[model samples]
Target: MKNIKLYQVFLALLGLIAILLTISLFIPEEGIRVFGMNLKFPTIGRLMHPKKQETAEIDNIIVDVDTTFADPLLQHQNGSNGDMGAPNAGELSVKNSTIIHLNDAGLVNLHNFFEKLSSAATAKKKVHILHYGDSQIEGDRMTGFIRERLQNQFGGNGPGLVPANNVYNTFAFVQTYSPNFKRYTCFGGDKLNSRKYGVMGSAARFTREYKDSAEIANETSIKTGWIELAASGSAFGRSRSFSTVKMYYNSCIKPCAINVYENGALIHQDSLKADGKSHIFKLTFPGTPGKLKFEFSTAISPTISNFTLEGDYGVQMSNIGMRGSSGTIFGSMDRGVVAEAMNDLGVELIIMQYGGNSVPFFKDSASVRNYASYFKGQLNSLKSMRPSAAIVVIGPSDMSRMVDGIYETYPFLPYCVEQMKKVSMEAGAGYWDLYGAMGGKNSMPAWVNKGLAGNDYIHFSNGGARVAAQLFYDALIAEYVKWSGKGE
Candidate 1:
C-alpha cells in the first residue's frame, strides 16, 4: 500500500509540472494579460495606437490697386519748343492675393526672427538670441546647428558660451579645463543652491577655490570681435574682493601680458590683480572681423563663471542646462543678476525647454496645474526682469508608460501639455506645442519606429532634435514675418 501511494504521488507531481509549463508557454513575451488592456511591459503594446496629425489653418489676404504719384522732372525734351514731351510720369500699383496654408506656425515665426537676425548681421549690428533649454541643448547639438545656420547667413563666428571647464562629457565641438582646480556643476548634486544658473536663467554664485598652483587657464579660442564675461553673487565679498582679478591673453609672443586681438591684430593690453570678487569683463578687439582669444591667470585662482562672444548683430544662443532639474528652481535664482546679464547680452529671445524630469512623478491634472503655476511665476519673474526679451515655452515630449502589459503614452501627458500652454499664455510668453509637434498622443512609438526619435521617446535623438529645432525655428520665423509685415 505504501509503494502504491508513493507511485501515485510521483505521477501527480509530474502532472503538476507539465501543467505549469503549458501555462508558461501560453503567456505573452511581454507578460500575461487578462484582457489585453493593461500595458505594463516595455516595448510592448507600442502599436496599440494610431498616428496623430496636428494641423492648423490661417488665411492670408492680398489686394490689387493702381495709383499715380507726382514726380519732379529735371528737364523736358521740348522745353525750348512750346510743350514739354510728356511731363515725367509716375505710377504705383499694388497686388494682393488670398492664400490658405498649413504648417507648424510657430516654426515659421522663428524663421522670421532669424530673417531679422540675418538683416542685423548684414548691417553689422550685434544681435543676441538666448536659447535657454534643458539637457536637449546641454550637448550643444541643436544650438550649434542654429548658430551655424545664423552665422553662415549673417556673418558671425565662434562658439558662444565657454565655461572655465566643461563638466559634461557630451559637448562635442569644444573642450574646457582649469589647471589646479576641480570643477563642480549644478548638474551633479555635488553643488546645489538657490542661485543655480542654468540654460533658462542666470545663477548667483559660481564658486571656485584655488588649490596648490592657484592659477587657472581657459584654452578656447574666441572667433568673434567681442567677449562678455558673465558672473554674479555678493557672497564672495563686497566690492574690493571682486575688483582685484586680472585677465591675460597668451600667444607665441614674449609680451605674454594681457592683450586683446581682433582679426590677428593687437588691440589692448593690461596688467594683473588678485581681488576676490565677481564681475563681468568686456573685451573688444579692433580690426577686420576674425577670431579672438583670452587667457586668464591670476595670483589666486579666480572663479570664472560664464563667457559669451559674438558678432555685433547676430543671434547669441546661450544654454544654461542643469541636469536633473525639474524646472522648478528658477524662482530661486537671483533675478537682479540674471536681468543684468540678459540686458547686457542684448538677449531678445528666451526659450524654456523642460518637463521631462518631472514627467515620471506627474500624477493628476491638479498636480500638473500646480507645476504649471510655478512655471508661470518663473516666467513672470523673468518678464519683469528682461521685459524686452521674447519668451517661448517648449512643453515636454511624449514619455512612455506601461499599460495593458505594454509600453504606451503616459496617461497625463496631454493634460500636462495643456496646463503648460495655459500657464505660458497667462505669463505672456508664447508656447510651442512640442507634444503636438511630435504628432500628438502616443506618437513616440511611431517616431521611434520610423527612426526619427530615440528609443527612450522622452528625449530626442540627433535627427529628432534637428527636426524639433527646425520646427521651432520655422514657427518663430512665421510669427516674425507676420509681425514685420513681410509675408503677403
Candidate 2:
C-alpha cells in the first residue's frame, strides 16, 4: 500500500510538469509574438504617433559660362611675359610618357639591326629573327603577336617554329602529332648530361638509338613550305647508318621518284640523293597549289639533330623553362654538340628571364655578387659559342606574401631585382625591370585583387600573361621605332 501511494505521488507531479510546459509554448517572452500575429501596444502607440507627416523640398538649376572677360587685371597678373609657360614643354617628350621605348643604352645596335632587316626585306631576301626565351615564349604568345604585327608591316607567310618533339601542345595554337618514336624533354630526367646548343641553339640528345634500315614516317604534310635536313654531333655514333635516303611525295605511289614539273611541263626526272649528309633539299614544282607529302626511308638509319622546313622571312621563338633553374646548367651540357646545333639553326636573340628561384636561397649582397659573377662567366661562355646573338635579361616580377593577415610584397624582391640588374649589366646584356613594369612593390595586391595576376602573385593568369607579353613587345617595337627613325 505504501509503494502504491509513492508511485501515485510521482505520477501526479509529472502531470503538473506537462501542463506547465504546454502553457509556456503559447506565452510570448518580452516583445516576442507568434508568427503572422500583430502585437498592439496601445499605451506606447498613442505616445509615439505623430499628428501629421512632414515633407522635404529639393531644388534644381542650370547655369552657363559668360564669354566676356570680367577681370582684365587678373588675366594680366597671371600672364608670364607672353612666353606661354616655356612653350608648354611640347607634349611631354615621347620618352617620358611611354615605358615601351628602349633605354639610352640599347638604342644604337638594335636600331642598326632593324635598318638592315628592313633593307633586306625590301630586297626580297629572307631575313630571320630568332626569339629565344624561357617558358614565356614556349607556346609563341609574345612571338606570335610580334610576328603578326611585324609581318603585317614587313612581309611574311605562315607560322614559324617547326613542330618539335616534347612541345607543350595545349598552349600552342598549332598542333603536331608524330609516330614511330617517343618524345622526351630536358625537363624530364631522360638525358642526365646534355649539351645546351649554344646561344644560337642547343642540341637535344635523344635516348633512342638509330637502327640500320630504319624507316620513320612523319605524318605531317607540308602545306606552305620546303623542309631542310640538318645534323649535329648530338647524334654522335648514329651518322654511318644513313647512306641512301628517299623522300616520297604522296605515299600512295610506291618507289617515289623526283618529278620536275616546270612551267606545267614535265621537264626532267632528277634522281634524289639517297646519300644523307646534313644538307638542304629543295623540292621544286610548277608552283601548283597543293598539299605536299614527304615520305622518308633510309637504307641506313640517319642520325638527325635538327630539321627545319622554313617558309618566307619570319621569326621563330622558343621557350625552354626549368622551374628552379639558376641559369647555371649550360656548363653541364655538351658544349661542342650544342654549338654545332645552334650554328645550323641561325639563332639571333636570347632572353634570359630568371632570379625568383635564387631569392630565398641567397642571403646578402656579397653572396648575390658572387652568384652574379658566376652568371656573368656563364654568359661569356654562351657568347663565345654564339658570338653573333644578342642577349636580353628580364628581371623577376613583383612577388608578395602575407604579413599579419594582409598581403605584402616579398621582403627580398627589391634585392633580387637589383642583383639581377647588376649581373645583366656585367654580362653586357639589356635589362628590363619586370617589377617596375608591374607597378613595383605592393602592386601584387592590386594585381591579384583586380584579377590581373594569379593568386600566387608570381605566375601570371592568361590575361596577365598576355598583358606582360604585350608590354615586352611594345618596348621592343618602341626601341625599333626610335632607332629606325620611324614614328607612330
Candidate 3:
C-alpha cells in the first residue's frame, strides 16, 4: 500500500510540472492582467533556454583599444597624396584612442563635411550636425560634451536646435513651456497620424489633432501658449552666447500672433503666415538676453517643429534624444519634412547612436540580423534624404543583464554589434564600435561598481557619459587631424 501511494505522488508532481510549463509558454513578457492586477510567471523562453554564462566572474579588467580601425581609409581626395597607404608612426599613435571604421566613400563624405565645418566661420554660415540617439544621450549628456568640444575646436556658439516643448530641460539651457501645449513624437508616446514629425522627430501644438476640416473650421476658441528660455549658469561658455533664434513651424491655416519678449519688455512681435506650409521665423538679438519668452495666440495652433539657438557662423550640433527607440522610426517618418528641415538647418553630418535598447530583447543570431536589416533601411532612408551629409553609426555600448544571480554582458550583444557594424558600413555609413570602446565583454559590472554606470547596467552615469563622449571625440579629432595633414 505504501509503494502504491509513492507512485501516485510522483504522477501528481509530473502533472503540476506540465501545467506550469503550459502557462509559462503562453505568458508574454509584459505579463497578463488578472482581476485588475498584473500577474506574471517565469517565461518559457528564459526557463527553457537559459543565457550562456561567462567563464568566470571578472575581477580585473584591462581595456585594450584598437586604433587601426580609426584610419580605415586614406583616399586621395582633393589632390591629397595619401591614397590607401600606411600612416606614419606619429599618426598611428595619435589615432590610438579611436575605434572608428570607415570605408572609402565614407571617408570622402567625412572629408567633405570637415571642409564645411572648418570653413563655416569664413563662409559666414552655420554647419549643423544632428546627433540622434536613445536615452543614452537624453538631457544632452554626451552630446553636451561633444558640442562644447566641437564648438571650441571649430567656431560656433549657442545650444543648437531645441524642441518647442523643451521636455528634457538640458543643462545647456533652462526652458519652461505653458500647460496648454501637447507634444507628438515619432518614436514613442502618441504618434501623429500625419507622420509629419520634423527633424527632431517631435512637434508641439496647443490644439489637438482634428479628424476633419469641419472640426478645424468649428474650432473658434482662441488658445494661448508660451515657451521661455533662460541662460544656464552651468552651461558651457559657447552655448551661453547666441545672436539668433529661428523657429521652424508648419501646418498653419490661420494667422498666429507671436510676441517675443526680452526680460519683461517686448522686443519683437510678428504674425505667422496663414499658409499651411513649412516656414522659418527668424529673430536676431544684439546681445544675449537675460530671459527670452515667446507667446503665441491663435484659434488653431500650428505644428511647431523646433527652435534653433545658434550663432551666424560655426558648427552647431543638435541633440535629438528619443527614448526607448532602436533608431528604426525614421523610415516611418515624413521624409519630405525631415529633408526640408535638414536643408534649412544646413546639416553637414548626421551622427546616429542607437542599438542599446534592442540589446536586451535579442534572443538569437537571427534576431540580431533581423534588427540590423531594419536598421539598415533607416540608414538608407537618411542617406537618401540628405545625400550631402556624412552619416556615422555608433554601435551599442556594453550592456549587462542578470542571469543566475550574476550580472554579465548579454549573450548576443557581441554578435549584434558585429551585425550592426556590417550593416552600417554596407549602408555607406561609418561605424563606431561602442562595445569595444566600453572595454567589451563583462565590463558593465566594473563600470557599475565604479559608479560610472547605473545599477541597471545599461545606461551610463554622467561621469561615464563624459568618458564615453571623450573617447568618441578624441577618435574623431585624431582622424580629422590625419586627414587634414594628408590634404596639406
Q: Give one clash count per candidate, in the order shown.
A: 47, 9, 0
What TM-score do all the candidates reach, one by one?
A: 0.63, 0.57, 0.82
Candidate that beats the other on TM-score, 1 or 3, i.e. the better one: 3
lDDT of each: 0.51, 0.45, 0.80
- Against the true structure, what is every candidate's RMSD? 14.5, 20.0, 9.4
Cα displacement (angstroms), candidate 1, residue 47, comes to 17
* Residue-by-residue lDDT tens digits, candidate 1, 1-488: 44568889899999997776665555564565567664333222333453343222211100111111133322322212211111121221112221112235434444544555646644545456666666766766566555544444344443455554455544322333324444444444444233434333332122243233323333222211123232222111110011111221111111122455544576556633333333465653221123444443333233334555443334445556666776766566556656766666667667788877777788888888888888888788777877766677888877776544456777778888888888777666678777776667777766666565666666677666766665565555455546456675
TM-score, prediction 2: 0.57
A best-first ranking of the candidates according to their TM-score comes to 3, 1, 2
lDDT of 3 by residue, 1-488 (tens): 43568879899999999999999889997789999998877789979776665432323322333212222222223321211111111332354455579988888888898898767766667889999999999988888888877776666777888888867747778888889888999888877777777899999988876658888788888899988887677776667767678889888777799999988799888999878788899976655557888899999888888888876567788899999999999977889989999998899999999999998898889999999999999989999899999998999989887755678888899999999999988888889887887778887777777777898888999878877887888778777877778524
